[model samples]
Target: MKSETVGSATLETWSVEEVEQAFAANEIVLIDVRTPQEYIFEHIEGALLMPMAFFKAEKLPGQTEKRIVLHCGSGIRSEKMARLAIDAGVTKIAHMDGGFGAWKTAKKPYIGTDMASGAPKRVG
Candidate 1:
């Protein structure tokens, strides 16, 4: 776990390995803060879409017990979202260290558009 100071709040961050472990254990709420088209291109498996364009802190899943982790194509959008979450009174929020690009560069598993139905399909 890593921490970033944003204003008076602290935003925790996780690496790809940590994110993957938490995901496999179902212990985190993974969110992708990118556009629908960007998400359709590729994303970490199990990530929920909550594009920053239409982001509303209140709309985020109210799963207080679970750690909330956000990510984007790179890390910029996720950082912005983290700040918004902090301003919204959310604490201990997190984002992937390098976002989807890093996750892919590390050869981590993901899901993306299916050739046939244009739906999502898991890929390793």
Candidate 2:
């Protein structure tokens, strides 16, 4: 994990592998801050869709036992949101570095769309 400063807040940026492991261990609440369209195309399994356009830091559930991790298409949007969360007085929050793209590059399992069937399919 790497830490980045956004304003006065320090955001923890985690690699895809780290996020994958935490997810597999049920140690994190993975949130996808991408658009609904993007999420419909493909997304990490069990990731909650909280589109950046309408996301509010206050909307995040208080997760004392589990870490709240954010992710997007790339690392950009998620980091932005993480900063917002921190600024909103959320003491603990993390964003996935390199986002879904990196996860795909790492060959992590995710739910993808089937164009013909218009259904969710598992991809690794």
RMSD vs true structure, all candidates: 2.0, 1.3
Best by lDDT: 2
Models 1 onward score TM values of: 0.87, 0.94
Q: lDDT values of the candidates?
A: 0.87, 0.92
The prediction achieving the highest TM-score against the true structure is: 2
Name the weakest run of 10 consecutive residues (lDDT summed) in model 2: 2-11
Model 2 C-alpha lDDT per residue in residues 1-124, reported as the tens digit of each score = 9987766667899999899999999999999999999999999989999999999999898987899999999899999999889989887789999999999999999999888999999997
The residue-by-residue lDDT of candidate 1 on 57-91, one tens digit each, is: 87777666788899998888998898898899776
